[model samples]
Target: MLKHILISVISNDKPGVVEAIAETVSDNGGNWLESSLSQLAGKFAGVIRVSVSPEQQEQLQSALSQLIEHGIWIKTEHIDADSAPKSDTTNAYIHALGPDRSGIVRELSRALAQHKINMAYLETALTSMPYSGDPLFDATGQLELPEGVDIPQLHDILDEIANNLALDLSLSETPFE
Candidate 1:
């Protein structure tokens, strides 16, 4: 039987970080499943899923621990595949941009939570505006909304937040490719 595991890795940003991780997983006979990786503030961070034979679990974990010598910190968790829940929800992509300020995420999340929406993926970045050179914040995410949720109602709530925060926000059924 295959054992599923979720692994998190963090290290100082550098080339070969991903190569090192892939090598470690392959060396232990683990099949890389899915992953989300990013570099932030000079740190390489990622979460990944891998599957291997039940007997190789310990061996895989032990080999992964060796990554410490290379400056990578690894944490592993075993997943009960059987306990994974199934969801029948619709997804929408949300994009928000405005002057860099606090509480943008907080207000957006509050509104989504009130409507029973969940963020499947979210990315936020700070950049400089073209002419003003002022700091701007941009947030993009895929949200999962429960069945029968009112789309128009959600938009109205978000509009209120945008108006209060001086932000521009939009939602779409399709995510930008």
Candidate 2:
């Protein structure tokens, strides 16, 4: 039998970091399934999902610890698919565009919180043009809505907030798979 493990790794940014981790898993006969890795503030951080046979679990942990001793911190957790929660919820994707300013995230998140929406992912980036003195910030967020909620009411609330914040906001319903 094979078991799934979710691993999170964090360490100083350097060459061959990913290679070293991948080699450790490959040497242990583990298959890497999914990962999201990025460099933030000069540090390398990542979350990876891998599968290994039950018999190889202990050896894999030992190998991971060895890597940690060499300066990379690793955390591993066993994921039981059967115990995962099921959701019959839907969601809407909200995209907002406006100049960089304070109170944008606060206002948007506050409104969503009041409606009991779950924010799954959020990304914001600020860009400045050479000729323009002001910077523009683009913000995108994915929000999960409860089943049987009125979307029109939600849109009205969002629009009201956006207008007050002087941002252009767009919302669309997306089915949760």
- lDDT scores for all predictions? 0.92, 0.84
Best-matching candidate per lDDT: 1
lDDT of 1: 0.92
lDDT of 1 at 85: 47
Kindly report which residue stretches of model 2 are placed more than 4 angstroms away from their true locations once superposed: 82-84, 174-177
What tens digits encode model 2's per-residue C-alpha lDDT throughout 31-132?
A: 998888988889999999889999998899789878977678999999974544477677678888877789889999998888878887777778773578
Q: What is the lDDT of residue 33 in candidate 1?
A: 91
Candidate RMSDs in Å, in order, are 1.3, 3.2
RMSD of 1: 1.3
